[model samples]
Target: MLSRCSMLPSSSDVQSLQGLSGIRHLAESRRFKAWFLDQFGVLHDGKQPYPGAISTLEKLASNGAKMVIISNSSRRASTTMEKMKHLGFDPSLFVGTITSGELTYQYLKRRDDAWFAALGTSCIHMTWSDRGAISLEGLGLKVVENVVEAEFILAHGTEALGQASGSVRPMKLEDLEQILEQCAAKRIPMVVANPDFVTVEARALRIMPGTLASQYEKLGGEVKWMGKPGKIIYEAAMKMADADASDSIAVGDSLHHDIKGANAVGIQSAFITCGIHASELGLDSFAEVADISRVVALASKYSSCPSYVLPAFTW
Candidate 1:
């Protein structure tokens, strides 16, 4: 494992990171021990690499610091890894990766013995169609078409579910409730993979798995959240990094999820301003307190604030 308590840049040194040109120097000089890279905007956008990402990653990797990507991506880890390689990102640069899909699979695998015994094999998996048709038979569980035919249900992402609701499309709460009612009548439990209510894509807001899960819980149905800011995902990332509470850092763009999750585990965090909330950058709120003021307020209300803020991952 890499050394966690190794000397970090003091406040004066931190000021240097505010500039992109200086980052190369600091990284080359061993200012940071390891980087907790955010996969989305920092490396590749959902479909492709952002400009300068490859060079930045290559430079950092050549500088000798350990790099690990921690993402909320719902795709399987293998898919993400393959995409990275396709984009010409040196796979060796990343010491480890923790994706929501991979983590969810592990969680199911470990609890299989107990879950299988209690729930039986018959199950209906209700989630977004993008989650793919996963068969639990390989996991020793049976797959059923609808809730009525199943004893249990595994609910993953909700994109496909949202789109299929009505002609207006993008499943709304009212439409999802109808499906939940069907499962509820049969007393089926669902395992929620991604637990975000909504995610900002570029500038527009879109529903996520958490949005449906929240509604399900309100209707007395059971759900499980996977990935960041969640304790399980945080714990798994730490274990992979071989890092302790005080020795690690979490860098992400989401204030509610990334920042809050880091605080829950007592780890330091750096908020990247470009991804979900790009408009907040270069504002007084950001300049006055580094992190978003709302996040600063939340941190103060619940716990300590982030260690620093950058305009973007590169900066």
Candidate 2:
């Protein structure tokens, strides 16, 4: 366990890379009035809850902490709630959730902005039907089979290629190169709802839509990002939480997504070292503490900083 600090920072506005033992320490400090949490790495690793994660959340809720889930998940908020409930987390504990998929669906349905209004309805949808697909049925968007017939690309999920022989079909990054080349040639714009390059999936990492969106950009295709590190999503989460920027803290594992987003929003951030960047931090287990210098170096490499660092999310 990390040595408990004698005292946590008195203000959430202070940006310090302090080491923290658990969520209980932060809760006791009462520095942050509300919490904006990331769903994947900070909460569960897809299949099961991280050690002490459920209890930590329960304790925070019982203490009346206003918490909101701000996720880069391509699944809608309701779908997220279903998974949370299945994992034995009480969804009511959170003020609400803001997911990239929910934002994408809203944008497509409302077409409230100039960029969305200019986009045509025909799109080649890359998705994961293996683990609950994100349906675009009500968006009034037509789903075309390929780039030739599509006007745009809505990337919700690209890792699963649908089931084959009763097994979940796996897709390679190279597999999408051909399709990406086609879209680039036709100048079809792509909307990446989730801007996380990869997500933790049961002790392993799975490629997310963000990686493909980045690749499409390299291929000269126009890409629109919608998730973490984006100011809008952060604002949406804060809106749901009714949190003041100075009184909130964002807890997440990804430096680029969570830390960078918090930096953009001018809030406190807690970095979980045991998540996606575990190997880079030289951690072999969740309980293994990360070298503070290396943790700082990693934060610099990602161009973001955390106000507090923890080996794992616990209480």
Candidate 3:
């Protein structure tokens, strides 16, 4: 049975979370020795780093905080690192990065586990044209153009791909539905490289791999989710951080991903309300303080309350 903590907050209960403060204030109060930070909403708006994110990460690093980025981005760790550098984040500030793409690559590379070993060599890749088949390259897996020829499906979300291709329009849901139908009819198991349903990009939301995976599952197809809100990615991050879950804290904007994943791994969580859910909760920006009552109510509604709540990630 699913725990109440895993339940999502209702739209009507969408409100500000209480205990909003700066990152430094919460760190001092919670005494977390390690940090697992989210990328899209917490550190950047998908295009650039949030105002104080770089400085704050630098300060935390200087203070000897062990940090690892736990992101649901479909990009591999090396690719994510390069993107971070381009967006002005120093690689030295964090110990390591654990992305869904990297995890998927590792799984395919190892192929030791039963599920992975059972996955046939031919796959239908639903990835960005620019990203190409880099993640699956060197794995000896054949990329097929059609679902009928595929033994499995590899999804990397459509919105990001469209953006990477420089298209102003978003991929339509109907197109995705058709693809899901074809895969489901063929009984193809899908591997969702990024398990985020939607992510915010400069105040606009885009569908992610998790959305497609969920839809496929609902349509009677199997899905292998590769990132947060799941335990596998958190375990990988924990190993990279070299810290126990008890002493670690996960900081992210999405309660569904960060908070739920941390709870599953016995780590405390700090929700950054200003990131993804800010506007829906009626907040101006990451800089604004949220109403305490509304925040508490929101937590109660989701049942996945964070140990701490911050207006934004700052020191």
Candidate 4:
């Protein structure tokens, strides 16, 4: 269980709830006009779409609720959309997607902000594959193979480094200490494209960019995170949905990313326990309703009190 200190900043106005019933509860209650849905555990498990995910999306769409699929994926929005289509999701179901990769790319491409403008053109690109580097093209940025010759570090996460070593497991601190040490010595700023510590992929949780970025910050390296738990992404999502905070609710499986982020932005949140915390909460199946006390305890542990709790995203 995650301690309170580990959770992201939350809003003081939103009090703790007893438990969540189901997605239909929110719809029936007419509590929100727009829904920001998470893509990973809530919609699919990486390999395929969840059993009722498509239909649930259809139901929400028919209800005239604005839907935006939010993701902490390191891939660009277009890439993410392509993958979602391949996985059998209807593109017309949601208004648009806001991915970490897309946000990072937009920031770099426009350089409208002070932080992004200060960044140099040459960077050491770190990713699982060359496809990850595709986001940097047409932005006048150069990708260098070596950290020593780079002006900044573009890190997707440690997963790529682990894969390069022929390991299917998540990368640990020891696996990245050497590279992190070099960047730290140079005081190089790192652009973390994805800000999720762990993501569910086919029932298996894997470490993501946020984990490595946290370690890098601990080692005295400057890091810029572009995804959830940060206010920027939430603001971007709200703008895309064109909804006010009071009428918007964020639904996701991770407390650290989804619930905490929603609270941070003063938007209502629904905690879906069947995704990443299923085993920890003793839930044997996605359809199994979690004990109210267990759900309350989990929320208390994270110091984030979501407005509702549900076993899964179903109508």
lDDT for each candidate structure: 0.60, 0.80, 0.77, 0.77
* Candidate 4 residue lDDT tens string, 185-259: 999899989888888887888777788788889989999989887888888888999997887999998887898
Cα RMSD of predicted structure 4: 5.0
Stretches of candidate 2 exceeding 4 Å from the true structure: 1-20, 160-171
How much is the lDDT of residue 204 in candidate 1? 47
* TM-score for candidate 4, residues paired by index: 0.87
Error of 1 at 149 (Å): 3.3
User: What's the best-to-worst order under TM-score?
Assistant: 2, 3, 4, 1
Mind giving the per-residue lDDT tens digits that candidate 3 earns over 52-162? 899888878876789999999888899999999999999988899999989998898899989989999887666654334334566787777567778988887563222
> Which parts of model 1 have CA positions greater than 4 angstroms off?
1-32, 112-119, 128-137, 161-174, 184-187, 200-205, 279-304
Prediction-by-prediction clash tally: 2, 0, 3, 2
Each candidate structure's TM-score, on Cα atoms with residue i matched to residue i, is: 0.74, 0.90, 0.87, 0.87
True-structure lDDT of candidate 1: 0.60
Candidate 1 lands at a TM-score of 0.74
| Worst lDDT 10-window in candidate 4 | 162-171
lDDT of 4 at 216: 84
Q: How close is candidate 3 to the true structure, as a TM-score?
A: 0.87
Relative to the true structure, candidate 2 reaches a TM of 0.90
